[model samples]
Target: TNNLAKTACINIVTLNSVAFYIFIMSASLPSSMRKLVVKTLTSNFRKAVEIQTVPLPNPASGHVLVKNHFVGINASDVNFSAGKYDPSKQPPFDAGFEAIGEVVAVGDGVSQSFIGKSVAHLSNGAFSEFQAVAGKSILEIPSMQPQYIPCLVSGMTAKLALQESGNLKPNEKVLVTAASGGTGQFAVQLAKLAGCHVIGTCSSDKKVNFLKSIGCDHAINISTENLGQVLKEHYPHGVDVVYESVGGETYETCVNRLAVKGRLIVIGYISGYQQPMGVATTTSARGAAALPVKMLMKSSSVTGFFLFHYANQWKSAFQELSDLYVAGKLTCMVDDGSSERKGGFRGIDDVTDAVDYLYSRKSVGKIVVNLASSGSKL
Candidate 1:
C-alpha cells in the first residue's frame, strides 16, 4: 500500500509538470508588436506613414489573431494613404491590405482548430507583425508561401473583373493595359486560358518580351509603337473586351477602340494615383458627359470593378485561382525587390521602398514584403 501511494504521487507530479510546461509555451507570445499607420494623408507613401510599437491585440469574439509572414503592396496603397479611396477616412489608420500568415489564437466562440492553420486575409493593417481579423475572412491556403499573397487581391481582381464584369467569352479579342503589371499579368493569362486572343500593352521591350512569354498574341510596346495605330491597323474591328487600369489618356484610347457591343472593365486609374484627389477625380470626370452618347453609338458599355464591393464571390474565385495555380495553368509572379532595388524588401521597414518600386513601373509582377525572417518561421 505504501509503494502504491508513492507511484500515485510520482504520476501526479509528472502530470502537473507537463501541464505547467504547456501553459508556459502558450504564453510565450510577445506583449507588443510593430505596425505601420498612416499618420498623415499624402500621396507620397513614404512620408505618409510611421511605424509604431503597441500592445499586441487579442482577437475579439468571432476573430482570430494571425502572425503575418508576407504582405502585398498595391498601386492603390498610395490612394489609400492619401484618403482618395475614402475621403472620410482620417489619419492614423492602418495602411496595408493583404497578408499571409499562421493563426496563433482564436477568440471567444471561434473554433480552436483555426490556430496553427496557414491562412491569408485581405484586411486593413496587413503591414503589421500581427493582426486580429474576423475568423470568416481567413482563407486557408495550401501553405504559407509568398506566392499566395498575390492571389488574394491581384488574382481575385483579374478573375472576377474579367468573368463577372467584363463578360469574357472564349475566342473574344481581349486587351489588357499595363499588361505586365501585378494584376495585369493575371488578366493577360486568364484571358488566354479562356481561349481569347489577348493583346497586352507595355512601355519597355523587356515588358513586351514578358507579355509574349505569357501567351499574349500581341505585345504592343507603347514606347515606340502607337497603341491606337496598332489596334486600328491590325484589329480594325476593335477589341471585344478591355481590362483598362491605367487612366488618363489611356482610358480615352481604350474607350475609343472598343468594338461594337464591347465591354470595358475599369479596375483602377493608376495614372492619377499620385495626383491630388481633386485632380484625379476631375481627370476621370473629363469625358463623363460624352460617355453615354459614345456607348450608345457602339452598343458598348463601361463597368467599374472594386474587389471590396464583391465580397461574396471572393471565396469561390480564390478557390478557382488556387486550383489553376496548383495545376500549373496559372503563374504567380512576385517581385521581391531584388531586381529593381538593393537587398530586397524584407520586413516592415522595406514596405515603403517596395511601394515606390511598384510605382516606378520597374517591377514585372506582384511586389511582396517578407515579414518573416529566415529564423522566424512559425
Candidate 2:
C-alpha cells in the first residue's frame, strides 16, 4: 500500500480505539471544515472519478504531456478489466494501450520538434484524458494518417508481427489463424502486400468471404472444415509460413502444417487468457508436423513476439512501419461500432457486445472503440 494510504488507514483504526478521543477531535474542526473533509472522502471508484481538476504532476526530464484524442480497447484490456489475470493488481489504474494524442507539455531536456505533433505508444493506462510518457516511447504519426486513431495501432502491430517473425518474401504461402479478428485481419492484408499467398482461418462461412475481400487468397471455416485437410488442398506441398494467433487445439494444427524449413511465428495466444470451462481437454491433430527435433535438423526458426517489448526495444524498426503505412502499401480494417446505445460508447462495454459478434466468427475487421465525445455518434 502507499505510505499515505497506510497512514490514513492507521488513523482510522486509532480513532476507533478511543471513543472519548473522537469527541475531542470533533471539537478541533469547525462545522464547515468538517463537512468539507467528509465530502472529500470517497466510497467507490465512481465517486473518486467525480472531479474537474487535473493535478499538477511533476514530470522528470524526457517526459512530455499528450492531450489525447483516441484510445484503443485491446483484448488484453478486457482480461485486465475482468480481473481474470493472475496477481490481480488493485483497481483504479487506467486501462488502455494504443492511443493517438498530440504533444502539448514537454518536460526539461527535450527537443522543440516534439510539440504539436500526434503520436502513438505501447504503454497501457491510456483510457484517460491526458498522459505524460517518455520521449523515446512516443512515435510521431505519419503523413497519410487516418482521421480516426485505432488505425495507427493496427497498422503498427500488423507490420511489426510480419516483419519480425516471418520475414515474409514474395509469393510464399502464409497461414493466418483467427483470420478475421482485430489483429489477424491486419496480418492477412500485410502478408498479401508482402507478395505472399495468404490463407486465413475463421470460424464460419460468413467471415470466409470477408477474409477473401481483404487479400486472403483462400479462407477456411475451422468449425466445419478441417484446417489440415484444407491446407493440403491449397498448398499441396506445404505452407511456407504460419502466423499462429489463436492458441489451443488450433495451435497444434498450425504447427503441424509448416513446410520443411518453414517458419512458425508464435504471435499471440488468446486461448491462454480466456476464462476456463471447468474442465481440461486435449487434441492430437498436427501429426508429427513441425516437430522440435525436425525443426533443428531443417534449421527452421520459431520466434515469439510481444509488441509491448518490441516497440520499446526496436524504435527504428517501428518508424520504418510508420513510413510503410503512409506509402499506401499497407491497408487496415476498422469496426466503428453501432450507435444504438448511449452518448458515445466505448471500451469493455463495446467489447462485451463485440465479443458475441466475434464468437459468432462473423466480424472480418479490426475491432475499434469510439470513446465518449459529446455530440458524436458511435
Candidate 2 TM-score, true structure as reference: 0.70
Point to the candidate with the largest lDDT: 1
Assess every candidate by TM-score.
0.90, 0.70
Q: Per-residue CA lDDT of candidate 1, range 1-378, in tens? A: 999999999999977876675465359778998899999999999999999998999899999999999999999999999998898999989999999998887889888667778998999999999999999999999898888887989999999999888887899999999999889999999999989999999999999988988899999988899889899999999999999999888888888899999999999999889987777533556586788988999999999999999999988999899889999988888888877556578888888888988888888879999888622212
Residues 1-378 of candidate 2 have per-residue lDDT tens digits of 699999999888865655445344334422210000011222221232222224534336988766555565455544454444423455445555666677665678877556667787656656555667888788777531333344445555666778877889998989988887777877888888788999998887878878977778989888899888887777777788888877767777666667877888876666654443232222443434436775776566677876655654445655665555567654555654553445333532343344344443445565555433423333
User: RMSD of each candidate?
Assistant: 5.0, 14.6
Per-residue lDDT, model 1, residue 321, is: 91
Model 1 residue-pair collision total: 0
lDDT of 2: 0.61
CA error at residue 181 for candidate 1, angstroms: 1.1
Stretches off by above 4 angstroms in model 2 are 1-60, 78-92, 111-115, 142-154, 204-206, 276-301, 312-314, 339-362, 372-378
